[model samples]
Target: MTTTRLPLFPLNTVLFPGLVLPLNVFEPRYRALMADLLELPEDGPRPFGVVAIRDGHEVAPSAVGLPETGKPPELAAGSGFARDDPRRSFHEVGCVADASTIRERPDEEGYEVLATGTTRFRLVSVTAEGPYLTAEVEPLEEVAGEGAGALASGVLRAFRSYQKVLAGANERSLAPGQDLPDDPSVVSYLVAAATMLYTPDKQRLLQAKDTATRLAEELRILRQETAVIGKLPSVPGAEFTVRPTSLN
Candidate 1:
């Protein structure tokens, strides 16, 4: 595999190939990252690696409290540098993303970025020598292993059941004429992204060895989730929650 260095953006969420990631870039370090990407040639893809934060907050605190002299305290809250060590702070597996649209905010304070996940990569090493994080990564290949197509068919049926359960529990109607893709790899990724699984489960799906393995896992997950949902009184409305990152 060819290894290359790419800028890293660690988030609290796991990204999968072909998923859309919209980021509100306001931090100075990340704003610099956007500026650097904008400087790249438009003809070339502006790619970066996005690894899930394994242990802490994605947005680090810039300061905690004022010192006795009324001066801003140094980064005391784990600081982004001290806490965000690549080897310890993030999952080794991640997805490479291509920035499709970048628009500067009218206030000129930040940027709104729309990026799409393109491929998977394994983080080899990381450094904070620069303003933002950068990593050496080896791209992971997507392979359709033996019996992928057959597994995909079963996964599709299981996914439909999963969706139905969610709709019933949430009192929402399913979209009419909805159909899933036939390609096993596409199905694997699509289901992985759509399912409301926790970050670790999503990471596990992203790290599956091949399409067949991913589909098999999805089949089991969908059935399990569907059964669990069926027993619940009612699925609560979605709301953001501060979940601790898991490294299992």
Candidate 2:
């Protein structure tokens, strides 16, 4: 796989492909990243890398203070102030997302946008020359000869179940006839990317390369959620705890 240099954003959350994540880009480094992206050529896919901050805060630097006493001496050389800075580094595995739609909010906090993930990439190296973080990335490809029909079918089934669960919980009617792609990879990508579950689960889906494996994982999650929903209370608006006598 060929490696490409991309702007990096280490966030507290993980983003999946086709998902709409609203981010507040008030931080100076990220603001610079967005500005740099806008300047890129319009024809090509302008991509960026997002990695979840595992140990430290993404907005600010770490609080380890100076070099530790018992730590490996070499670790201290590259490990103190740099660890605290958001722009200093990022995780290795990240997806390259296309900033499809962007709307600037009234204030300068940040722009709201929908990003679609196109490919999975691993961060090979990073350079901290400018305000934003930039890294060399290697794209991971899907397994060959994976049929689209089976994958799409599995994804569709899980998605339908997910929709049903959402409707049951929210007490809303299901939207009808949403068109899904026939290709398995596309289906898997879209469904996995658009889910509202926790970031770690989404990251797991993103990292799965084989179509069958991805579909299985998604199906498992769907079934678990469905089972959980079935066991929960059936009363609508029960979460609010309104008194029974107040309704009269």
Candidate 3:
């Protein structure tokens, strides 16, 4: 029920709780974000809101030398930059992430950050008055809804079956030897992250109302995907790897 302010980072991918995100931050705006996180108290958690981009590019066009008019040249021409409504560029529901490690590249181009998703939040408002986007968000509760434990068990079995099918099709392990967690919420998120679903599908999983809801949906998805993969002649290569907000 409580609301909090967080720096916002919009990317093309969706993040789920307990999933680790590795970011290659080279954009000026995001590089600034990394610098701010590096300045946080070493012992305290450095958190940010990571929302998926609804439209437009994650890397913005250079706005330098453009007149400070009502719209930037790209906005006026409709071809130079992203959408004018910054708020519309990103999804409203997102995950909260904690930066565990931030290392500066040798060339100082940007930072290589390792972060893990922690929780979910609904965006209330976004502001661009600073170097990067920031938002006021209401935290989403991690409720273990009715029959979550049973649903979790079903999901795990379905996921194992999915992994086998996917491996046969793709000839690769998603993450071999990774011990799957047992807590319902953890299981829900872990499956959501590890699954090879599209970004929209993953976002839907992240936005599920509770653990049981997510598990139920995942159970259906796993079965559906496994069946489809089992029928496939061969699977194409996919980018399986799966980013932070602003600072003043």
Candidate 4:
């Protein structure tokens, strides 16, 4: 596998390849991370890694979603170095992302970073303790296997059922008619992103070594969640959530 040095961003969330991540960049350390990233050659993709904070803080007072997600409670918490807390550190596996746009925050106090997921990587070693974390990482991919046949179709059906149950449980979701990607790897990552799962659970999916194995896990999780939803009493006026579903 190929390896490269990547600047790191630790957050309270999990990111999946082919998904978009919007971040509130306010701390001085991360501000430096953003600046260094901007200096990279624009001729090719400039990507950074995002690893879930297993025990530490995001190192920024702000961890806002896009304007639509509203402000989460964590945004209001304290900001500091991620490693200041004795128990804080990042997970070893993470996704690399390419920033599509970086704009100054409306208040002009910080910046908003909008990035699309590019690839996944596993940390080989830490090269920088911080201004922000940096590390050597090996790129990861699903073990190449045949795709898009009966196994895939069954997985797709399970995903649909999972989404239906999830929409009923939640208040909103992506729209219909648009279909899932035929690439098994892409579908697995996309489904991992959309599913309501714990950060560790999502991380487990991220570390899966093969698309076929990931699909099996995805189908199992979807079925498990769906069955849980199946036993719940129906809401009188509940509707399937609808918005654009395609991550691409």
Candidate 5:
């Protein structure tokens, strides 16, 4: 478990490794994050950590000057500047993402970044003394064991069945299957990214310490969702598009 200080991007949604996250770099702080990453050597990979915000605002809270229960006055009464320049509290686990494409926005406000999730990490500490969040992160890996292969196979089977339930693929329907990896770690993240599960559920899967646990959680979620849809037939989030960044 190697630790490094990397720029952090906190969002409202969870990101899984091996998934793609498209982001609009509109906010000032996040725009700063983009700039910082840009200054890194482009010869190799330039990446940042993205963690899900558990509370507070993605952008600064609207009523900024007011002091929270234990916060300092400069953040509240001391600063005449209205915007406290704060970041939200985020989940402990995050994914390191490498930018695949970057372009200037049409209006020229900020950049549009397409980041591909590379791996998961556990955020150790957040250094918010800068323009954007920077964090000390320890990289996380799948603790696969002898049983992980069996778990992966079961998860793959369950995921296919769940997809079929969602597609409503009747006897005549010749729909193809989603392309998923055979490796347990890759399979866990890929299916979690593809599924439209709730944010907490996704977070739970992300926080799972090993491939076996993550795969089991995915299977449980798949079965639960499939059962719900089977009875109700018109569940609200039956389908979802891959979400864009909440750059705020």
Candidate 6:
């Protein structure tokens, strides 16, 4: 696929396609970005990339190797740092999210916006355009059709089991099998993000290129979560509440 330039927001959390992320945007740059997005035509997919800043904070451009010209660092082909490297600046692959719903804070300080991931995009380069960072990116292709359904089903079942365990641990009830999308890619993303074990695990799932790979990774996480849950007391209390669905 031909690559295109996109505005980027480097965050601490990972976002997956089809998952909804609520962001508190307070910085002047992001406020401008949101304003520009609101002005764009909303007919097609209104998307932007969300990449996790690897080493330094996203709010500080100087930490991510912003050039003397005050431009965002370019992600060229020779860039050889691992995504998990603490020295690296950002993740190469990120999800494109549509800013579907937004509510501006009355104080005019920031906005509480709800964004839904629409597709995966790879960062080819990044440049500072005024306040926010922009990236050259390409859309990642979906998994092959032949095995998508099976992979998705496996992931859904695992997710169901995980949710059950979570509910049991917290003595809470969850409406299982509620309004899940039929698409395999979407299902994989939803399950992975919904059943969060750790940030790194979620990041791995988000970076997985295909449905099959993502399903396998999610199953592994579910098994690990189950094992950890098993070692704990069966008594229901706020202990299990430490890991809430809101974090996921």
Candidate number with greatest TM-score = 1
Model 6 poorest ten-residue lDDT run: 77-86
Q: Could you give candidate 5's per-residue lDDT for residues 1-248 as a string of tens digits?
A: 67999887776778888887888665566667787777777766879888887765454321122124432222321122213432326778989999777666686656788888898898887776777668899998768755778888987887777667666423221244436678988888877776666567788889897888888888887777667656654533444322222322
Poorest 10 consecutive residues by lDDT, candidate 1? 239-248
- What are the per-model numbers of colliding residue pairs? 0, 2, 0, 2, 0, 1
> What TM-score quantifies how close candidate 1 is to the native fold?
0.84
- Model number with the top lDDT: 1
Which residue pairs in candidate 5 collide? none
Runs off by more than 4 Å, candidate 1:
60-78, 81-85, 168-176, 234-248
The sequence of per-residue lDDT tens digits that candidate 3 reaches over residues 105-188 is: 786766778899998999887777677777899999899999999999999889888787666344334555577878999999
Instruction: Please provide TM-scores, in order, for all candidate models, with all chains considered together.
Output: 0.84, 0.71, 0.83, 0.80, 0.78, 0.77
- lDDT for model 3, on a 0 to 1 scale? 0.74
Give every collision pair in model 3.
none
Candidate with more favorable, higher TM-score: 4 or 6:
4
Per-residue accuracy of model 6 over 9-127 as CA lDDT, tens digit each = 77767788777777776556776678778777766556778876565564433112222454334342213323333225787778898988666778665567788888888888776
The global Cα lDDT (0 to 1) of model 6 is 0.66
For each candidate, what is the lDDT?
A: 0.75, 0.59, 0.74, 0.68, 0.69, 0.66
User: lDDT tens digits, residues 1-248, model 2?
Assistant: 68888887666566555554455454456656776777777666667877765455543321112223332121221122254443344444677778665555475544555566667787777666666667788888776245546756866887787666556344322364677777677777677655555556766776776766777777777677656655557634333331111000
For model 4, residues 1-248, the per-residue Cα lDDT tens digits are 68998887777778888988877776666667787877887566768887777766653344653334333223212243343442246677889999877777786556788899888888786544456667788998657455534556667788787666655345334444557887777878877887767778888888887777777887888788677666667732233322222221
RMSD each, Å = 5.5, 9.8, 7.0, 5.7, 7.7, 7.2
Return the lDDT, model 6, position 68.
Answer: 44
lDDT of 1 by residue, 19-121 (tens): 7788767566777788999999987899988888787564532122112343222223233434555457888899999998878878676678889999999
Predicted structure 6, TM vs. truth: 0.77
Give the lDDT of residue 198 in candidate 5: 58
